[model samples]
Target: MLRLFLRKYRTMILASVFFFYLGCCLTINFTRIECAFKTSSKNELETRVQSLSKAQYVVIILSSPNNEPKRDAIRATWGNFVNNIFVENGEIINKWNHTRISKQSQQNVVKLLFVVGTLGLSGTKADKLGNEQKRYKDFLILENVEDSYKNLSLKLLNALSWISENLKDMKYVIKCDDDSFVRIDLIVKDLDAFAPSMNAPKLNKFVTFKEHLPTYKGLYWGYFNGHAEVFLTGKWQEKGWFLCDNYLPYALGGGYVISRRIVDYIAQNMDFLSSYNAEDVSMGVWTASLNAINRVHDVRFDTEWKSRGCKDNMLIRHKQTTSDMFQMYKSLAQSNGEKLCNTEELHRKTYFYSWNVLPSSCCKRN
Candidate 1:
């Protein structure tokens, strides 16, 4: 009888312990979930700007009044190319104007904002003495920020705010100049492939430049003037190449992409000092400061695409004529049909390069 009573007591004790442990686990999990929820809520304001549906891609170009001619030219060419090429392939192209975008479709559209500064004076008048007088407000001017670097910081903040307010549902955000032309089909394929690749970094998006250095003493490569001298330090010096990770804080030129999370973070926290020159470099610095990793892709940007032939697997081509942009679009649309001869040859040369290169020099040691 005593043995039976002891067995019952032991079973009850075991049950009590099991329940206690389970309760503790449930509490911990609930706490973690709450924290994640808060973080998501904070980031939602920015991430929600990404529209994932109207089309798979969003292209952003910065244009000024001076570039209107080029814009018109490119638009005409694209109109022809889209009609002749993309429509036949069943690929739909939608113009992402602020008014026409739907709430649901807006959520899927990528937001691209071009930040174009005016070069010429606006609204000038001759004074009574026949001397030319310029109006301050009419001039494209930077805010009076601390240093030149701070101007860019402020520009990004303002630009991002404009984007968030106007394009609340975009999925991606790209900032490019008027002279750049992206191979939309190639960019879409690359992003689609990159999105699922385990090798890609979860944080810090891609940045393109001539070179990078991590341990250099002065400003990072591409920080100063466009033609700044390249410094040598660390293993990169020996290899005669710059890595993106080292000088991310001072990146410049071409353009870059920002995921919704980072954009939201920046929008929420826009207290950085402004920089007057090289907004792109300041952006790199700002992103680096946020603990984001700026990655480098192998795609060639900011070069004459026509000279190299329009068929390369490159995601973007810089310094393009309006005609070149249209031609490239047409080529991509017809890629499924009889392949264009030049494009085929260009693809053959470019397909061997992989976008999976790592920022760390670990492999070099081996």
Candidate 2:
């Protein structure tokens, strides 16, 4: 009887060990499945955006939730500068609340959206952002991700994905940082005029790269140039992806406009592309991968101000202080071209020096 009891106990131990190993195997498999599901969900986000139909143009601004002052300055200034005057309660208001661009006669309608990600483990940021969104109705919040400097590329991917899904009908999509001042007035006007050129059978020779004839289809516009060893460095390094050589010709990241076709391409191919911590370099890599993409240079869209002075043709300025934004907005409101240009010129001289220059053959500001 004793021997029989010992054998039963041994059998029970074996069964317990077997089940433990089985549980471990199942847990590992479940983890992988969860990761794959997250990836697929991210990929499917574009499909969702595509289903929402497209718009004429979308100015996607990258902002963090904590940066309320910057966002407010933008909306109060350049955001509502174009065709945004309307009468509300017997008073003329320039705020987006009363100003309607959707019903305007112009085909180059521009919609503004601030894209942001959530803070980790804290719901306060999301709540604040939600309230802000309700008040402004212009934010595109990425709920699944955390907001961090390291996530700029991911944030961009989210922006492109969302734009492709919701605003795909837009002729052009402008991606700018919150600190950027986009001359929306000029941009809308120029895009309206340039629409016909985009639809033409052949593209205007706006920008040419390495003897490659320019085409209008995959137009990526910004202040572009050749830079040697311009890839991310230090903490922003891309790990396995080393750029021992010069960076391929690409736009500066502070702000740029891309056609709907390129947005669509990026939206579809996002899952397959490798991401770098530096959002701009990652953009360069993705565009470089596609033959159809063109790195067009236009001085007006100064992603990094290098001009000795701001001329009348200045369109976009980056890295402005909050005070500068307000001051610039006041100048814009006054339509004081001379003052604005002088201020911009002063800013250019103060912030940047001409270390390198692009060839004169590159595209001129339109």
- Top TM-score hit: 2
TM-score, prediction 1: 0.47
Task: Judge candidate 2 at residue 125 and give its lDDT.
Answer: 65
> Count of backbone clashes for each model?
31, 7
lDDT of residue 282 for candidate 1: 52
Q: Which stretches of model 2 miss by more than 4 angstroms?
A: 1-54, 84-108, 119-121, 195-215, 228-235, 305-309, 336-339, 342-366
RMSD of 2: 10.4
Clashing pairs in 2: 49-165, 50-165, 54-168, 54-169, 55-170, 56-170, 310-345
Q: Against the unseen true structure, what C-alpha lDDT does each candidate score?
A: 0.42, 0.66
Deviation in angstroms for 5 in model 2? 49
